[model samples]
Target chain A: MIQFRPIYVICLREFKKFFREKSRLLGTLARPVLWLFVVGNGMNSLIRPQVGFSYLQFIFPGMIGMTILFSSIFSSISIVWDREFGFMKEMLVAPISRVSIVIGKAISGTFISVAQAVIIMVLIPFLGIHLTVLQFIEVVLVSILVSFCITSLGILIAARLTSFDGFNIIMNFLVMPMLFLSGAMYPVTSLPTALRYLTHVNPLTYGIDAFKHVLLRNSAPPLGPEFPLAVDLLVVTILAFIMIILAALSFRQKE
Target chain B: MSIISVNNLTKKFKTLTAVDGVSFSVNEGEVFGFLGPNGAGKTTTINILCTLHLPTGGEASIAGYDCVKRPDEVRSSIGLIFQDTTLDTGLTAYENLKFHAYLYNLDRKLTEKRIDEMLSVVELTNRKHDLIKNFSGGMKRRLEIARGLLHYPRVLFLDEPTLGLDPQTRNTIWDFITTLRKQEKITVFMTTHYMEEAENCDRIAIMDHGKIIALDTPENLKRLVHGDTIHLVTEDNEKACAEIAKTFDILCHAENGGLFIETEKGEEFIPRLIHSLSIQVKSVNLRKPTLNDVFLKLTGRTIRDDVLSDDKEVTREFVRSHRRAQR
Candidate 1:
């Protein structure tokens, strides 16, 4: 049977590490705040009327996705750091199954990612986005799911990397494209047929779509064709599951 | 019973055979040391027994659990202190121990007690709350040792536990380990390239080129050295060398303007040589057999020479710079 104590201990340590580093905490929040105010407002005049909502409001969910995506993926960089510093040997030599380490990392990343997203969620009122308590709860639930999926993806990538430099190069290359394709900065409906097809394939697209669906429920008419909430949740859940298994498999390889 | 047993265990990484059909068993409560220079498969053997790497051939078991087949049981039974410092520098010393306790499935009260006891054993109780990043190398090593023992495994594997420490710090660490052996009766299986360090082990297996070149107690291994070495700087090397060879019936070589001889009871032979030799000897130095002598006898080279030949320039440079910085 899988033990719960190790997983709990690992998750608690990660949480402690994340909070103890004041600079890292600020860094996680800074990017999203910049995008929300500077990028969102800068483009507001040009894209607001076309999307039927203020650009800041339109991009809020995408900002949440961005926060979750960057923070979660960057958190996996710790695994590479651990390996370099010999701390990975301590964890690997432990009696607990490798799966526990992966699960613990995924859970911790999800927690931190959610925590960062909450920082964005607090600015919901300033963005003029209206949401009832139920809608807020729905957004949180979707945020947790997206965080898990992205964190698992991070773990999978990190398991195969031996150096932080390599992880940074690969993660940056992948993360920017992933964020852009996910329709976080723009509406998927306005994309050309080719880019729309790409968005359909991007898993983060579903995450942002799910968030937009819930956060914008009481706003003006739906900005895009409403992909059923059930479909979005199913896709994310499946992606998270697959990424977790892949992460575990990659971790199982001989060190 | 042997706490660790291996039957022709071999580990090959692709084309290179790291451990070439090595076999040995470490009995319970015994301090068994694996001594070798770099690239001699000492770490490979330790890794296989620790279940970190699977052997390509043969079999091994730790505390009656097969290392490959029942890795979890083996891992649970063995505590590993890696050559490199593995403590999480971001965490406090207490937090590091707590994490290990939880991993080993220790209960709340037991975990607390063990953490406290281990911290005290390593004499880090006062600094338990301090982050490891602020710790010195010796302090981090002590914390790692405390963390390793918190689980209280049946066997403790220390891979070059004192690799980079100073002589004083290394002695303190060894004191803690020897004390632990007597107090807890845990078998210690360690690897080191330091000949003096290996002298502390109950028995040692000397490895070279991925093979066991010799295995015996330090005293017994020293006995394997044919005789004591004598270096004599005489008034005339040619005459002294000829007289010593004829008089002692032992071969002597003129090296670096000195006569070198290997003879039994070199001290006794020294007086006779002085009495018989016509020319006066300037200086006579008689040295007893050391582990380096034993290694030389077996491999025709010293461990340092072998280490220098190994192409681990990065590690060599790191150790050099680290030592220089420390000085």
Candidate 2:
């Protein structure tokens, strides 16, 4: 019998490579824990919500979005490492199509990011931010979209990066700022006018808004706040597809 | 018939022309060496043959298909061991091979069988389960070899295959490569800076500054410069060089403050040269000229000093220069 070979092969290879490091697993959990247990309770004692839904409930969806965002972006760093270790050269020269290589890396990166989200999902009951049966399914769907978008961006950045260290520099520069600006840790309305405009430019903003709409009762998601849900997803998907094409084209063997 | 052929292939990056109007072909089941010092575009030529990079000018076809248009078919026929050691440290030797096998969409039963054979060839069967992070540099290199051979490619591209390994490991690796070539009847194309490695090939192409200096069997290449070589030691090298350049029509090269010359008339010319120079000769030994002499004659230098990457040789910039220096 034939097997679902390449996909399963890439997925298995990526999973072990990522989970091989224990701290990666811990880091994924630590951020969501701090937001749900420490920051949520900290904000409860600090700012009173208008609906009185408590900060623990308010930050849960944001923390999930934060986990997906950080994990997705940081996964891009593996591309830099692969280049440094010479594995990328091997991949570039493999018999498979360059498009398949891009898909393999994107699928692997998104899969890992989604898994991190799953770990946080397991802790929802302990933190008292429970998801109803319907909300649970929506969480899965949103995770997939956020995973695909961030993973695509990750591959795009990797395709352009030259040095092994520059990937970490990107994480420090763009990922942290984007995470904070996306309203992942707090409500968007509380921010200044110009900051709200900046949120419109962030992909995570749409991800979090959709997430909070389904998860947090007190937060108003304002359906497709950044752009229409279909339109924004189509834009991100198109951007991702274009990048995939570029990454494949960049694999042109040098003479 | 030629198994691989390229006609007037030229590749340029920005302002620099790394390979200019170079053309050569490898016959079926023959061992070919692309011999050149670093930055001579040896790697670039191999990359093009492996279908990793595109050629800017000219055309290269492998096994009768265009490399650029039919890359999948070309890649399927050739396995590449990059000059840089590119093994995945996170995976074990087995996993690396398995991953490559899957890349080619190998049948499960056949892949397992081939993986077993490759592990035995590299002599790493016992270490199959250990993470590649724990492998010695030589072991990692061997792992790369096995991975390249996983899909049973008809041709193997080994760029500086033994570079950076210890002599003992290098010998073992070479034996393994030679054995693989014989057993599989695979055409092996390699590039290296070492004279001996080039000599071992059935034929070699000496490349300099992105140009092919000469292409022939090692013995024939050595024959082109001289029938016999004579070594001369003298501190008055420039004067001796001038005198020899004037008196006899022969090739002379300087190395470590000594003059090596190739001429059948060494004994007859020796007395005249000594008398003309009027200097004490430290020593003189006659032997055959080598590919080193051929390279010096074509490139005019024993080394390419212009390609050194200043201070960023070990940084992420190393990768940048690895590409940028092609220009």
Candidate 3:
């Protein structure tokens, strides 16, 4: 039988480590809070109020995306750290399958990312973004799906990197473009033809679009393509699965 | 029964061959030692037996399972202590052991018992709850040994377990390992460059240039030197060497401005050499053969000579940095 105990143990250790480091927890929270209150309010005055909702309420879902993206990617950097410090050798020499290690790491990264996103979730009332109970549940579900996909992506990147500096440079290179092209800061409908195509291709675009769909379905205008809710769920679920499989394959190649 | 059987195993990395076609078998419950200088394929062989690296040729089996084909079985049957520190320093001693137990699928109740038992064995029970980052080098090594044995593996592979430790710490580490062997009856396959440490093993394979130059019990391997070695400093060293060689029909050579001879009775030869030489003997020293002598007799050089000139250390660092760019 395939044992899940190892997976659970690894995830539990990650959670313990995450909680013990107070500075890291503060850092995870600080970035999103800054973007929500300072950057959102700053940008609100410059952009025309085309969307029915205010800028702070409109960009709330984007802050959640930002939190998930940065936290998951940062958490996955531990893989490279483990390898450099020789702890990776200990985990690899264990009796369990390499796939278990990868899954364990992905799960831990997902949990941490979701936890950071929930910190933003508490700002709903403060930011004046109204949501029904059903809408709140949908928003949470989409956030989880997005977290899983992004964390899996982080694992996939981390499996191939051996140095923390290399991982940081690559994460910044990929994350900046992903966030910028994701339509998280602005509406996709207002983008030029070339930029609009880029938004369509970026997976984060679908995630943020899904978040906006669930959180502001009644209060705000649609940002981009009005795909059905089912399409967003389907795309996110498939992307998460594919990224997980890729991450597992990358780990297997190490042997 | 033999716990490990390796047949002409080989491992090559691009242009460099780290392990050549080499073979050796370790009997069950035997403390088998691979004595070699650094880069003599000791670590590579251990890595293959532990299923960490794929062999380029030949085969190896641990607990009757092929290392390459049935890696999971091989892995489950073996515990490994790497040359470098592999413990998670950020985690506490107990947490490290707990992680290993869960990975091996040990029962929850049994895992707790084993963790406590191992901590006591290594004498780290008092520090079990403390983070490993604060541990001394000796303490971390003790914890690693405890972690390695937690799963009750049939075989344990220790790669240079006491590489950089002080003499006292090295002895204590070996003491724990010896105690573990008597209590658990697990096979130990370890690699080391320290000649005196290799004496603790039941049998040792002296390796050089990726090949086993000598394999036997410590006593028998020492016997390979043939007899006690006598070092003589004479007024005429060259003449003394020729006289000893001619009269005793034994090989004698000039080393360090002195005459050296290997003979059955070093003391008996000393008197005859002084009487027969017709030259004044300044000094005579006789000593029994050691593992260092055995290495010198077989390879014509000390193990330290090879270690000093080894470029593998530089290559290892280069490889680490290179792996980063390759990704």
Candidate 4:
């Protein structure tokens, strides 16, 4: 019962708004620059290249993960806005299936997140990291998968949230934990058993690990991909599927 | 023929029943209204018919499709303007309408034509390019009406369409609604607690406590209460009530610091009562019975009493400000 036209229009509306609010694009882009230059450099001086990679190069994939994670999750905040402004009823009363709305939002969030991830790749030359054209393409593909996975999780959370009050809770409890435990800033192998279990559960762990597979191919064993590339993609794809189904089911509530 | 049919429809929210065995029908090309005070289940009934809520009992249908069994068909056959504005304030008016057209899956070639036609119907073509946040309340309402009709639905459901607008804007919206009924050949099923607004309907169903107390044409409902209503204020309302009952044999009820009585030939009766009563009469007002009087007569209390309480007024103001802050 899912219709293509509704999904297309929904995504198109999001795309139009994304460009209209120029501040949003600027704001999402600003975080990566600050992290890459300010934090990465300060950490670079403090931590030596004990594993054959500078701190700046080691956290490069983590920076991309940061960009995608923030952009994708914040994009789903539109659902809360729509509900507050009463526009969500318009879609609910329409002749389209709820699945279409969920997919439309997920697709829009993924594209926007991936766009920012690509923009982050501009730092590769500055970081003195070499990337083949195929490697760059593989990185973009992983970004898309990771973005969709995080955005779907966001949709599932937003589906039940009635206002922005829950947004702060999500930021503190969900987004921050997912980033810190995902091995984006540090290696998961060095973590103790308790936090390492959380890293395994976080989807971004597999995503950033996939990035390390391509970007850090020549790095020492401790700094390279934590799991096989196939395992990373498989986990992300499965999580994305489950999150989207749960989000759509939440929208189907008869309230 | 009837386009909307409901039979013994009921909806319960845990312990309280919001819609209790309500039944009504709306004919094609007719303006049918549900009039009642707040918490009277008018909104709950509309939500069920719009396929937004499931009825706990009985059945309802729009355009031959069951609301519960075939919600997609019911949704496709009807357009809804909710009690609150649903426009995306970030987008232009034209973009909002375009979003609606896409949601309804209108024909690609006809979409532009329909959007333009609906905009002009609401006289919003000039403001189509403006962002909705910049538009006034009345403008936002007109755009919502336009977007609702872009899909060419068989029936249009409006839940308290003119709730917060000023009198002038309310009138203008009503003009567009009536004109669209003819121009689009569409059925209108609207709910309102405004008795004055109920006059605009071809048929009005007075609801209270989740039940339809009375259903008929406005004129016929008014006819249910015989004669004009006379409001008299005197030095002693208690004495006036007794005097009027003893002398004129018409029982007068003291309400809102006045004595209200129902009698034929109110103009002549007012003068005779003033002369006959020993008490001094400060003022005497007489007017024809309105939908309010009809409701008062049927329900034993005025709808105004339920709707015009002090707490309700404060809550309404708070809600209005809250909505403004949200925008």
lDDT of 2: 0.76
Work out how many backbone clashes candidate 4 has.
0
Error of 1 at A212 (Å): 1.1
Per-residue lDDT of A1-255 in model 3, one digit per residue for the tens? 345998999999899899988899899889878988899889889876655767777778787888888888888878888888888888887888888988899889888888888777888888876778898778777878988898889888898886766865776689888888886777777778998788776778888878877776754445533456778778889999999999988888743
CA shift of A219, model 2, Å = 5.1
- Per-residue CA lDDT of model 1 for A1-255, tens digit only, reads 457898899899999999999999899799989999888788887774554567787788889999999999988768878878888888888998888999999999999998898888888878877778997788788989999999999999888675666865775678888999887887667778998788887789999989878866544434642477789999999999999899988877762
lDDT of 2 at B145: 88
TM-score of chain A of each: 0.93, 0.86, 0.93, 0.97
TM-score of each: 0.92, 0.88, 0.90, 0.95
lDDT of 2 at B63: 86
Q: Cα lDDT for residue B93, model 3?
A: 95
**What does the interface RMSD come to for each candidate?**
7.8, 3.3, 2.6, 5.2
Given candidate 3, what's the lDDT at residue B78?
Answer: 89
Model 2: colliding residue pairs: A253-B52, A253-B53, A253-B54, A254-B53, B229-B287
lDDT of 4 by residue, B213-327 (tens): 9999999999998999999999999988888888878888778899889989888887788899899889889989999999888887788798866754554454333333322
Order the candidates by DockQ, highest first: 4, 2, 3, 1
Q: Regarding lDDT, does 3 or 4 come out ahead?
A: 4
Chain B TM-score in candidate 1, rounded to 2 decimals?
0.89
lDDT per model vs. reference:
0.85, 0.76, 0.84, 0.88
Q: Model 3, range B1-327, lDDT digits (tens) per residue? A: 898999998877666676778888999999999998777778878877887778889999999999999988888898888888988887899999999999888899999999999999999999989998899999998899898999999999999999999999999999999999999979999999999899999999998767888899999999898899888898988877787778878787566677668888877777877788878888899988989889988988778876777475665554444434433
lDDT at position A115, candidate 4: 91
Chain B TM (all candidates)? 0.89, 0.87, 0.91, 0.94
Clashing pairs in 4: none
